[model samples]
Target: MPLGILEDNKLEHVPGTAPLNELGRLDLEIGQAIDRNILKHDSTGQIVLVPQPSDSPNDPYNWSRWKKELFTVVIAYGCGCVGAVGPLLTPAFVPLAEQFGVPLQRFTLGCNGSCIVAIAASSIFCNTLAVKIGKRPIYLATTLGLAVSCFWAAEVHSFGSLAGARTLQGFCMAPFEALIPASIADIWFVHERGFRAAIFNLGVLGGINLAGPIAGSVIQYGSYRIAMHGMGGAFVLMLLMVIFLMPESAYHRKGALNIDTGDKVIVTDKLSEASIEKSGVQEVKTSTTSIPSTEPPKSWTQELLPWSGYFDHVSFWRTLLRPFVVIASPVVMWATLLFTTCISWLVLISITLSQIFAAPPYNFSVSSVGATNVSSFVASLIGTLAAGPIIDGVVKMMSKRNRGIFEPEFRLPVMITYIVFTATGFFAWGESLYEQQPWPVPVIVCMGLINLGIQLGTSSVVTYVCDSHREQSAECFAIMNFIKNMFAFGLTFYVNDWILEQGVRNCFFVIGGITIGCALLTIPMYIWGKRARSFVFRYKLLDRVLKAP
Candidate 1:
């Protein structure tokens, strides 16, 4: 009686069917349990669903496409709004510097300080919490945190308070950053995830891109304090929207196969009863099946929960520490390295964006620098729109060609885009600024490529890592993110010095070289990622450690 058609009780046999293993003729009817089939049919109708959905309508995968897409749009929009708070202050740095009587560059520390909390929240605590409590709760709590932090940003009197507010805002941001990809895995089939993730990547990074312009206009009309007020107000509306619109994405469906064996496509679901007890649940409930069903067609009000059932059966400590165990995996390591390198370049640009454009041959006002990012915003949006579905379509094509077999590597060829555009963008942006060429060249063309590259890389790697460890996606993401934040957070502290000492031309050239080198790791991953995963799974303590028995 759940959404799709259920399997019939009786098995129908064909006419002239031979019994007792006596059939010599080919009557190849491998129609095994149609009800269980999560048929994500492609043009080449070799029916498959990666990891597959359960028979329950309560399963997120079974939700109506409208609900899933609506949730995604909200996620993209909310994440974009919240993330903008991070760098909106870039255009306002001069005003902030003057307000606090500090050097202009000192504000970079305030921006970077969020990296510290982001490391803790995203890499470990908040991401781990999302697995237990569910993403809706974390979303509400984090949105509230962003709201309060923004108001604090407006009122903060000293550099310390400003840094504290920014850091807290970053803390609020980490859960959204680390959780969205893993959460998308909840409702979307693997083939559909690329474009959806593009939406997410756009919101978070695009928010950062769009913020400069917003900050410029805000600062142009009023004070930097006004920008914080506006950002805070925006988050408040986002909070209300989430409370009404965002339903739970975390579903406790049993995996069809063991991820450790590499026997099937990896899919992570919330903890099962056996795993829950193993993870450390003291008392068991009669319905150890799942959290409250968002199914059965509830009233408008009943769809929302006062709070999610966080850690009722799952172990928080085990989930918190799981990232460390995952890092031991070479596949996860390479993905982490790729993400870190990509993020480093983005951060380098954000910290110095206003500084570069505000004072130079251009002599642009705060608003102009902000407007420069508009092209990046549009380009990245279009790129994500095009890139996501294109990759999804490619996966279907390749899967059909492979006789309906899907490999994680099917996504890697797409990352070739990352290598080409990301490398070129970094070199051109830096070189143009270094040479003082026509300003629009770097602002539009060069920066647009980097934005596109970053979005593409993000969608690919998140899919790669999440698909590989879907059985324990929280741990997988936490581990990859742990390393990613570590690299990005560490760089944030002293990137300014590195830029000042090296000069922008040499600085970007070096960073570009590093990214190109790291991007090549995708080669081995595409070719031998399964073997690498198998090697890690062989360790005696890997399960007990990472899965946390």
Candidate 2:
């Protein structure tokens, strides 16, 4: 037998956590053939494109390197900008609180709380619609909606009005949160998705870290309303970028790769009938593939149209159920726990920044408070640049050592880096703030370590889940988006009071302990993850609910 081919192709395992020859494990050894017609990299015949591309020119997988890079960049920028909307007014929160005649706690609840809940609620509908119609139209519509909401926020005269505008912004911002991961899966192959996904995460975290400084600068010399106006203008430019630069990534190829068992590659052709035998489920009825279109490549004008053809095969209601069904999977649940814990710290830091810095010992101006985020932004950038390529390289190295068989657990080791940075960062931040150390202490070194951990942790959880649950990555992310933000929202409900009651030093000491506890979860999952995956599949946990009427 060839080095890469399994002695017995198995159908008894889950999608991406199967044994020797299956979805998660790829035959990366040189000179091994998956199929005669499957596409392989020209530079190295060793690796085949998973979910192989069709011969169609419009398949996102077939796009040129430059084109793909451009699209990724635009998408990252848009996601980042939209994400920044959550905290665009963080530095101005106090001034806005004064103007609206409300306590700062109520103000944060109305603005940030509304936005977080809206993002969670909107994920369900936006994901369903994006899958049904296409993501491009949603992107354009949401960008416009976000711009309008920001402008409305600028003009708001009351607390109710501000909250309403923020709710709308949350709705518009939802797609970028839930759909970007799916978009990456749509375009990039497994090998490339780690880096691509990391870029998008960077955009989101970076925008948030940078928004404070930008808003602070505007608010320092101007007013809260002026800061809103500045944000609104930025989104308008983002809308124009989406209009001209972005293209539809959704494509329905003639063939379908069975990600469940990977026992067979089902390549459909009009001239030949193909059938798929799903593991322990009913076999697909034999059918001839639709004839390939001979249409010429789309011009720029044609690409601008909002509608790409529908993915008629996908059911909106069924897709909607997946977010809930995936909750039953232990892998997904663990990912959510890990992600929410890391993200909560980031959110807490953002929420408490102005309060901590603008008060007594520091007595910093809004601009100075905003400038503190520069350290986190720089740290996140370094993590982004390093984590992605290192992950891909690590996976390849581990796979080769295991006879070209890859397991999603290969990604978990990266979490060790996350654990060290986050735990230590929390202790340092707490101590520095407690002692009323100089701004450079907690703001620079401490925050840098914290954000760096966040970056690494975010990339690891996202890439791991996407790789583990390739077919259900979008739904998995939907659940993650909802749960994590909801967790953040819940924290906001009590976080302020809790900090006041416990004091900063004690609160951070507790937070650091919780963070370490959460990071320690990587151990059990790394050891038993494959078993958990198999358990989910063997029992048909998600399948029962997903296939239910």
Candidate 3:
């Protein structure tokens, strides 16, 4: 028997199961009679591959595992570089403020706040273009722009000039948030994406946390200008990688209709009649013809071409507006709230760290302030490595309990850890700083807990959205990025003020309460999520928007 095929050939139907076509009802189960040849299967035959790969070897899904991993690393590095830029100057906030003859709040508003707004504003346009054209050119163009912006930052004499460069850098960085997740979905299967997405998120958090130390050391020893120049040089190297190493991952899976069989097995393009007969399979339900691609794979040089041909079939205006439509999704809204609250804490903690430690009881040096990020970096690494692989295992174990049927809600149990870690981290962090307990309490232990929660929450939310709304994953992510960044940008206007007014302990107490509330949303989501997906699908909400003028 084939790996995925059960010898008994009995199809078990679980009660209250939503239709297979419902948005979030993904049936990833073992022992399905899906023809392994027609639809891709994992090595264990434990699960049917989502968005089955085409025969053309150029499909990113068909690429060798090592090749996919290498490409992922290159992209992750770019994400890290972008992640680093926003905070590289954070360590020098005080000195930069003094040099520019401005207050810390005003300086942060110009530099960090403006950059976040830019990141929010630019994501929709960049994502639409990426979906319409190709990801390769966007990656190259934005990376090049980001590199130049870094060089510009190094030369800036005025606060205005620095803000301008940072704004440009933010615009370039926007694509990574939306595109990287989409690219991961394109390359990896559902079961494989948990860990892979973790890797990508790790790159981002790693870059962000680690950049603090590098910038601090540089600022302490030399100057912020040197740090800017070093960053520019780093981006230049990333650009070269984009040029020589990265291949276009934006392939249009044209005419691919994911027909959800009762078992939630995808009946891709064409089914094998002979195999179906041999397996004694009956009642195959499909609405579209399944045709395998026979096109020859592109040559190495061809793959290296920066621009793949335009995806003319993708309407630019429609793609641009799609995220707005997708924003209506309950799943997307929950994800935005969960993801925003989770990631914003990282930023909140980051921007405030220098201020808290630089003043009063701690009176830490600039380098010491930046050095504190090492704890976050180490904690993020540990959290990611621990959570990534385990996510897949948890899903598999739960699926087995459900008679091998998979629902996106299976991803939510991990959010419990997110709640515990984040709530505790916030409360502890604030109290530690307020009590002036030692540097290690807030900097090492508390910060570590917060970062750990961030890794868990971020990876789980991204993976969940992609799995739940696979077709609109790009649009969903685009809007989520926009909302989350906007949320962060808005916070900058008042974060410092709020901290001063409310005091660190109270501010964190409120934020910790909010964190718990956000994480608790997972409970309702786990219960009613499938029904909500069904209601949206049945109502044709997305279709109405897509067809509108």
Give the poorly placed runs of model 2, Cα more than 4 Å off. Answer: 1-14, 17-39, 256-296, 313-315, 547-549
Candidate 3 error regions (>4 Å): 1-38, 254-292, 310-312, 547-549
* TM-score of candidate 3 relative to the true fold: 0.90
lDDT of each: 0.69, 0.76, 0.78
Better of 2 and 3 by TM-score: 3
Tens-place lDDT digits, model 2, residues 418-476? 88998889999999999988889898899999989888888888888887777677778
**Ranking of all predicted structures according to TM-score, beginning with the best and ending with the worst:** 3, 2, 1
lDDT of 2 at 299: 78
> When superposed on Cα atoms, how far off is each prediction in RMSD?
9.2, 4.8, 5.4
The digit string of per-residue lDDT tens for model 3 on 79-104 reads 88988998888877887799999999
Report clash pairs, candidate 3.
269-290, 270-290
For candidate 2, give the lDDT. 0.76
